[model samples]
Target: MSLATSIRRNLFVLVGLGGIALSAQGAAAQPLDSALAAAYVNNPTLNAQRAGTRATDENVSKALSGYRPTLNGGISAGFQATRIRTPGALTAYENLWPATFALTAAQTLFDGFITANSTEAAESQVRGSRETLRNTEQQVLLDGVTAYMNVIQAIALLDLQRQNLAALEQELRATRDRFNVGEVTRTDVAQAEARVADAQYGVSQAIANLSASRAVYRQVIGVEPGKLTFPASIERMLPSNVDRVISLGLSQHPAIKASQFAVDAALFQVKVAEGTLMPNLSLQGQLSQGYDSSISVESTGAAAVTLNLSVPIYQGGVEYANIRQSKELLSQARIEVDVNRDAIRAQAVQFWGAFEAAKSQIQAAQAAVAANTLALQGVREEWRVGQRTTTDVLNAQRDLTNSRSALVVAQRDRVVAAYSLVSTVGKLDAQSLRLKVRAYNPVTHYEQVRDSWAGLRTPDGQ
Candidate 1:
């Protein structure tokens, strides 16, 4: 073969291989559902939030400890010497050793609502923690959806840019041939070349955007996303009414629930503070055995049981201040709950409206894509027949590409909105969604450890 023909054949082979590689790379991308699931399981931020929730369950143990008895033990042995003198006379010295040991147990028999209120507060705190974790999970889920949609959008834009580049190359070639035949001006060829360059630049920019978007997707979903199949529709996932949507959000939103728990805890603080003004009764017992090497020089054992009462006299207004501070905190918590409810309602309205508008945009974009496709075909045919200029065909092609990209964006928006609405309703927990992983159950673990106090144990009879 001639050297020129050999060069041309090698160029064709390279182009073919490049196309195959691009196709394979696109195909290797993971599906969106799988990416989301992976994110749920592996995302470090979400796992950290889960750990925080588990830590909150420790409050249950703290609360239950108030109901249990406290036991303490101590032992001591010592020797002492004493010297006695009469005026200026000689002095006499004596040494003595003593040992003492005590084992003490105290059980709260009665306190003016302190222990009860504290336990209630701890329970509320646990609830609050779970809700906060749920809120964090929902936010993470939304971020994942956004990242996924962004990747899809960038990919679609990249495809459009590539197609435009190909079309522009073909047009440039045709214009060059026409110029050689003296049918088209040099200016026309230059314009075609400029368009091709611009299209190539567009392709480069799209690729950059796709890369950045993929990084974000990996950050949220905990893995590199692969090719994704578009959903058929997302309208079915949207809520029906704005009022109902707001109501559901207010009832289930984690922030609001957490605030409610805060209020409960604050109220409990007030009770605990009030309990300081009343007497506390406790049952106490002690048993001990010790040896002394002094005058007695013997082992001693003692057992005794006693009832004790402690009354708070005054603490320079500290108790009153605590009560006032707790009351103020309770008031702030109540206000926060209301504020959260209002904010959630407003967000529901906004997202629901966006979802509805996105549905319309999808329909309109789909129609636009169809119309622009036909328009581009007509413009291409007119140019071929010498009835239209190259500019006209190029313009139609650009419009068609834009319309297709818009359609993909609209489709993604619709799906994201659907997910947002679901998240707003607070049913976004893994168990509620029937996710594959085992849901973390804080209550079960709390129950298991709550009654086991630090110093309390089961009785011998049991």
Candidate 2:
């Protein structure tokens, strides 16, 4: 479509254009889903969180080490001088090298369940980190949506401002012609000139706003935005009411789940700390070889094994203090779950209300645009017929421009608020959105590292 025609009908009204439209350069419009996919795949903040979760996965491996045996080896070599005398009949002096090699292993039979509790705590922490990653993903996607819509809205408003400027410039020329013919006074032309200057300033502001939006789009979506297609309707995917929405937020929000997992981890940590006060049982074995180069002695080999038990006898009050500290942390984590729920509830209500209000505002803005468009046309004709003044025409034009701008903003708000609500309810993920991108599987990393005995490289060989 021509730029002028597109501006007049409003780009959003062209939703029937094959579910996709061509930009001014005749390229296929970039869909919002594509932008979201880009953000999911390439946004640095989201990827950093993924890395953090992978790092958290190592905690389980470290914790599991407590269940494994430890083996160590040692070697020592030295030169020795020996002198022997036997009842004044014979005396001998000799130089020899003595060497020793030893290997030792220790296996824990029991440690008051400390290993088990620590492993459990580590696993819980991994789960919580995964949830935190999910929350970060949701945030990145929401930011992507907002940035995408802002760019589109800025572009549309800029177009409207330029169009308004063109219209006012034309009006100024007409007013000057009328003044020359003595049909209007100098004051009328002056008024038209002032309005033109205001329209010019509006265009500059619109350009600056568009620039700002583009920069944000790049930051969030990981690429400069091309002509972005208006997002598909999310109303069908939304919950039916505020109550249902809040319920979803409470149950499905990643922040709440993360907090709950933190509570589990903290509870396990408390047990781990308490385990320190219990007796520890372990078995140890050692093998040693000693060699001496001399006339009579060559080498000796020996092995030994021992079962060891350690009962804590209160060396200090540190263990008790640790137990108390762990309990306090557990309490804090429990409270954090409730805090997340409350925050999610508040956000759900706020975004839902904003979404609903945006819908109403769109309707009102459409009506206002329609009315103001008609009023401007009428005022222009009346001015030509000498029934309306220059100020009336200028005011009518400004009203129409403002209404169009409001319509664009309302449209942007509706789309952004819908996505924000989805995010608040914890549904704004790659699977939920069905974006055509490979989803990052944090579980795959956790599973790969869990119970693994040895590896210097990560799952991705990094």
TM per candidate = 0.85, 0.92
- Model 2: lDDT equals 0.89
Among residues 3 or more apart in sequence or in different chains, the pairs in candidate 1 whose N, CA or C atoms overlap within 3 Å are 29-226, 29-227, 30-226
Clashing pairs in 2: none
lDDT of 2 by residue, 1-462 (tens): 543453466534422222433235655568999999999999999999999999999999999999999999999999999998899578889888999999999999999999999999999999999999999999999999999888888877787889999999999999999999999999999999999999999999999999999999999999888767777788777899999999999999999999999999999999999999999999999999999956488998999999999999987899999999999999999999989999999998999999999999988987787677678777888999999999999999998888888887888899889998889888999999999998899999888999899879888988
Instruction: State the lDDT of candidate 1 residue by residue for 1-462, as single tens digits.
Output: 554554344333222221222223536755555666777888889889877776677677787777889999998878878787898899978776777889999999998878898888888888888888788888887788789778777777787788889988998898888789887788888889888889999999999999999899888998777666453343455568888788899988898898998898888888988888999999999999877645445677889999999988987999999889889989999999999988888889988988889889977876676677667777877887788887887788788777767776776777788888888888666665555666666666566566655444322222
lDDT against the true structure, per candidate, is 0.77, 0.89
- Model 2 segments more than 4 A misplaced: 1-28, 81-93, 293-297
lDDT of 1: 0.77
What are the RMSD figures for all models against the true structure? 7.3, 3.2
lDDT value, residue 383 of candidate 1: 80
